[model samples]
Target: MINLNEVLKTLNDDKQQEFINYLDKKNKRKDAKNIQLVKLLLIDKYSSQEISEKIYGKQNKVALHALRKRLFQSLIDFTANTCIKEENSLDVKLIKYIIAARSFLQKEQIEVGYQILDKAKIIATEYQLFSILNEIYHTKIQYVHQYKTLNLEETICNFKENQQQLIQEDNLNIAYANIRKSLNEYQQKKTIIDIKKLIENTLKTQNISDLSLLSFKSLYQLLQITTISSSQKFDYYNLTSFATETYKIVENHTSKNKQLYYHIEILYLISNIFFRNKKFHQSLKYLQLMNFYMNENKQKYLKDFSSKHDLLLALNYNYIEKQEEAIQLLENSINKKSSNVIQNLDIYLTLIVCYFQHKNLTKAQNLLSKLYHTDKWYLEKAGLVWTIKKNLIDILLQIDSGHINLVESRLKSFKRNYFKHLKDIHQENVIAYLKLVEIYYKNPEKASSKEFYNRVETSFNFIDNKKEDIFMMSFFAWLKAKMTKQDVYLVTLELINS
Candidate 1:
C-alpha cells in the first residue's frame, strides 16, 4: 500500500499529461469523466468509491464497479508506459530495436527492418553484449535468407570469435556468482562449518589462483575466509591479525574511491570482530578508519552506515563505562528511516539494554512496548539472536519494574513460544538467567547475600567453556555485579576488558 502511494507520488506533470493523452487516444473521444476520475484517484487521499460515485452516480453500482476496474487498469498501464520511457540504457535500446525490427519484418517492411537491425548491431557491439550479438547475427542471417543479400563471410567469422569470448566470460561470471552465493549463505546463518564445506567443494572444482584475475571476487573470498576461519576457531588474535592484513590488501589492490563502500564494509566488519573480542581500542581505531575512508571518498546517502556505526560506538561507550554517552547515542540512533540498515534489531536491542543498565525503567519499558507492538519486529528467519535478545529485554524490563506477576506471565509465553528451539546450552542460559531473576524476586535477602553470589557463580558453570558468547556476555556480567555488590555498568566494563 505504501509502495502504491510512492509510485503515485512519482507521477510528475509530464507523466500525468502523457497518461491523459493515452486515455484520450484509447477512448477515441475527449471523455472528460475518465480523465477527471484518474486525476482524483492520483491524489494521496482520494479512493475508488469517491471517484466511482463522481463518475457514474451512487445509484449505478455495477457501472461504478466496472469504471473502477477500468481506472485501475489505466493507472497500471500508465505507470508501465512511464517506466518504459524512462529506461534509456544501451542494452534496453538494443532490445527495443530488435523487437521493432521483428515487428516490421512481420509486415514485410524489409528496408525498415534492416535499418532497425543495423542500429541493434551497433549497440550490441558498443556494449559488448555478445550474447545479444549472437542473436543479432542469426537475425541478420534470416534477413539475408529472406532478401538474398550479399554473402557475409566476415560476419560469420566475427560471430565465431565473439562466441569463444562470451563462453569464457560466462564461465568466469558463474564461478564468481557461486562463490558470492556461498559467502552470502555464510553471512546469513554465520555457520562456519557449512560455509567451510561449501568453500571446500567450490575449491575442488575451481582454480583459486585464477580468482586473483577477478580482483573484487578474489578480495571478497579472501575476506570471508579470514573472518570465517577465525570465528570457527574462536581465535581473536588471528582474527585481528587477519583483519589488519585484509585491510591492507584492500587498500593496496582495490581502486580507492570506486570501491569505497566495500572498503568501509571491511573496516566495519573488522571493527565488529574486535568489538566482539573485547578489544575496544582496536575496534575504535578501525571505526575511525571507516569514517576516514568515507570522508576521503565523500560518499553519499550514509544514513544506513551512520546508523550501524552509531550503534557500535554506543556499544563501545557502554562497555567503557561512558553510560551517558552510550545512552545518548542509542537514543539518537533509534527508529531511523534508512531501509538499508544492517543491524536494526541489534540497535534496538542494544538501546533497550543501555536504558535498562542506566536504571531508566520508564524509558526502557516504553521502548519495549513500542518494539513489541510494532508490526513484524523480526524481519527475517536467520537467527535466534533477535528472538533471544528480545525475550531477555522484555524479562529484564519486567524485573526492573518489580512486576513479578507480569514477569512470570511474559516468561511463560516466552518458554512456550521458544522452548523447543532452545536446544543449545547458550540459548538455555538465557532462560536460566530469567529464572534466577524470578528466584531473586521471590526471596530478596538471598539475592543480596554472599551465598547468593556463590550460588550464581555455581549455576553458571555450564557457561565456563563458552568463551565470549556474544549473546550471553552482558547477562553474565550483570550476574557478576549482583554477586559482587558492584555497579552493573562498571562490572560489564571490567568483564569486557578482562
Candidate 2:
C-alpha cells in the first residue's frame, strides 16, 4: 500500500538513478546486503540471461533466487517512464546517506562524509550492523578526512583507534584483513615470493563473489613470483581456465562503482607480469586497458598517477616498439612529479630505468643525481637502495665515454675493499649476490675468474632455503665445471639429450 505509486510518480530521472545507484557503489551496496539484492532484481528485470552473461559472465542460482524474490516483493508497477518498488528497508535508507558521504569522500571531500557517517552510527547501533559500520569508517570514510587536508596526527591517531574497533569487532572481514596484510608486507619490503603467497591465499578463499576480478589477481600474483624465480610452477593456461570460470562469476554480479580503481590495480599487475615475461602483445593489451581505466578514474582518486604505471607503461611501449610514446610518458611523469619524493623509491628507480632505456642520457643522469640528492622515502631499505645505485652505475657506464674503465676499476677496488661486502652472509642477500654476478659478468675481466663463481655460489646459497628452479642448479653446475676445466657444455648437452 503506502502510496508506492505516488512515490514513483513524484520522483524524476535523477532521483531514479539515486535509487539505482544504491547498489552501484561497492562498499555501500556490500554493507546494505538486502537492498543491493533488490537493485540487482531491477536490473535482471530489464536484461536477459545471455545479456547478463556477456556483461558479467553467468547467472548464479543464489543471486538468481535473491533477484526473483526481491522483484516479487517489490511488485514492479508499470509506467510510461519509471518503475517503483514498495517496502524499502531501514538498511536501504541508511545506504543512501552512506552513498552521499562516499561521493564527497571520493571527490577529495571528507567533512560531509564524516557528518553523514555520524548519522549512520546511530542507525547502525539500532540495526546491529556495527561491524560493517565500523568498516565504513576504517576503510574509506576516515581516509578522506585524513587526506583531504594537511596531515593531522591527532586525526590519524583517532582513525587508528576506529580501525582497531573495526578489526576487533568480529576479527574483520576477509577482504579488509587481506588488504591490511598485503599492505603491511608491501611496506616491509618483503619479497615477491612472500607477497605472492599472501595474494594467492587471498584469491583461493571461495568467499569472493567477484570471480573475474579475483582470479585475474591470483594469476597476476603467481606470475610475479614466477618472473624473478625464472620458472613457472603454475600453468598459465590453467590459470586462464580459472579466469574463464571466474568470468562466469563476473556474470553473476553487476559492475561495482569501485571497479575503476580496482581494475586499474589489477591491470597494472598484469602489465608488469607481461613485461617481465616478455609477452609484449598481451602486455600491451592490458596496458591499454589500464590506461583507459586509470585515465578515467585518476581525477576521482589522488591526482598523481601511480609512478609504477608510468614506468611500466614506458617499458610496455618499448617492448611493443613504441619508443616515442614510451619516452613521452616517462618524461611527462618525471616532469610532472619531479618534487614528489614523498612517494616510494620504486618510482625513482623505475624512472631511472625508463630514462636510460629511451637513450636520454641527460635525463637519466639527472634522475640519478636527484635520487641521491633527494631525501625521498626509501622505505629505509638497503637492498632497494643498492638496486637503484647499481642500476644507475650500469647505465652511466654504458652511455658515458671513459666511464667504463673507471667503473671497472671502481668495481675492482670494490671487490677487494668490499670483498667483505660480498662475503657477509647477511649482507649477501639474494639481490646483493645478483648485483655482484651482474657486476662480474659485465666487467668481462671478472666473469671467467674462479672468485666470480664463488660469489655466484654465495648467491645460490642465499636461495638454498627458498624454493628455486632447476635453472639455478644447472647454472651452478655449469659454473663449477668451467672452474675445474671440465666439459660443462658437453655435460649439459647430455642432460638435455637424456
Candidate 3:
C-alpha cells in the first residue's frame, strides 16, 4: 500500500485519470476491486486496515495485496506507453528505428532493413548514443555477409570505435560517482578532501577536453560536478570560462528543440555561475537565454525551472541594489508548493536574509520560526551547508531582536553541533566569525573600539575580495556594519563591490 501510494503520488490528476481509464479497459471482470483501492488511496482518507475493511467488508490482507499489485503493474504499463509517445526523445526514436530494421531483416526485406539501420546509425552517431550505436553495429556485423552491399570492415571499425567511447563514458561515470561520494562524505561526516584537486585530477585523467564530443547529458553532469567544486572553493572565475565554453559547444552541436531540457538546464547553470562570480550583467544575459528556451515547446519545463530561475534572478537583483524587486520575487515564491524541498527552503532562507538586511527584524524572526522542521530533517533534505546557514541566521535574528537568552542558547547549541565539523572542513573562519558575534553580543559597546576592530581583522585569514564567497561577505558585512554603525545592506553592497 505504501509503495503503490508513493508511485501514484508522482502522477498528476490527468495522468491518474488516464491510468484509471487504462485499468478499466484492461479489466476483464466487472467486479474488479483494483479501481476501488486506487480511488481509496488517491483520496488518502483511510489506513490500510480501514481501506481493507471498506473494500472487503473486513480486514483482508491477502486480497488487498493482490489488488495493490495489479494497480501498480497497470501504472507501470501506462507510464511506459506514455514515455514511448514522447517523440522528442532521441534514444526512443533510435530504439524504434532499430526495432523496425530488425523486423524487416527477419522478414528478408534486405533493402528496407539496410535503409532503416543506416538512418539509425546516423542519428545514434550524431547524438553520441554509444550503447545504442553498439547494438546497431552488432546487427550490421551479424548480417554483413547476408547483405553483400554492407561493408563488413566499416561496420567492425564503427563497432570498435563505439566500444572505446562506451568504455570512456563508463570511466567518466565512475569518476563522477567517486567525486560525488567524496563530496557527500565531506558534507555529511566532515571528512576533509580537496574538492578542486579531486575534480582536476579526474578531468585530467579522463582527458576531457574537446567538449563537443560529449552528449548533452554527459556535459551537463560534468558541469554539475564542476559547479560543486567551484562552490566549495568560492572561485567561479575559471568555472565561468569553462561553463561558457561548454555551453557554446552544446549550443553548436545539439538541436535546441529535441534537447530543450538539457539546454535550459545548462543555461541556468551558466547564469548561476556568473551570478556567483558577481558578473551581474553576464548572469542576466544567460538567464534571458534560459527563459527564452524555457518557452520553447509551449513552456513544457517552465514550471520545473521557475523557482530556480526566480531565485537566481532575485539574488542578482538583491546584490545589485534592487531590493524591492528581489523581495517581491521571493515573497511571491515562498508560499508556492514545490516538489523541490531544498529549493523551497532556499526561497525561505533568502527571503529571511532580505528582511534582515532591511532591518525588519520582526519579519525575519517570523520567517525563521516558520522553518519548523527538525535539524535532522533539514540536514537530510537540504544538506549540512543549508542547515548551517539557517542556524547562523537564526542566531543573528535572535541577536538583533534582543532575545539575549535565545541568542546565548542558540550560539552555544550551534557551537556544540557544528564546531568540530567546521574545523574538519577547514572552515575555521566560520567559527571565528561566530566568536566575533559572541564578543559583540556580550559587550555591544566594544564592537566599535579599535581593539575589537583589530581583533576582527586578526581573527580572519582573509582571501582576495574577488575570490571570497558572497554569503561569507554578507555575514562579514554585518559585523563591519556593527563596527562602523552603518546600514548592513550598504556595507554588504560595499563589500560585494570591493
Each model's C-alpha lDDT?
Answer: 0.65, 0.48, 0.86
Name the regions of candidate 2 deviating beyond 4 angstroms. Answer: 1-252, 256-258, 295-308, 338-347, 354-362, 373-401, 404-498
Clash pairs of candidate 2? 56-250, 56-251, 57-251, 58-251
- After TM-score superposition, the amount by which residue 66's alpha carbon in candidate 3 deviates from its true location, in angstroms, is 3.4
lDDT of 2 by residue, 1-498 (tens): 233333433344455566555335423434434444444433444444643453345865566555545533443432222222322345566777788777887775667777777688666644444454655555453565455553456545655665554443333245445554544444344532343454456445533333333322332333344332222231232233343343344334244223444445656655555454445577677677766666674354234345656777776665455667776776677565532343344555555555554446677676666655321234344233344354435434342423455565545544543445334323344345446545644664575687877676666443331123222333333434434545543443333223
* Comparing 1 and 3 on TM-score, the stronger one: 3
After TM-score superposition, the amount by which residue 390's alpha carbon in candidate 2 deviates from its true location, in angstroms, is 4.9
Preferred candidate (lDDT higher): 1 or 2: 1
- Cα lDDT of candidate 1 equals 0.65
TM-score, candidate number 1:
0.63
**Each prediction's TM-score versus the true structure:** 0.63, 0.43, 0.91
**Model number with the top lDDT:** 3
| lDDT ranking, high to low | 3, 1, 2
Candidate 1 lDDT over residue span 117-227, tens digit each: 888887666545667888777777776756556357876787787776566456555655665555444334433234445555655555444332333434554566556
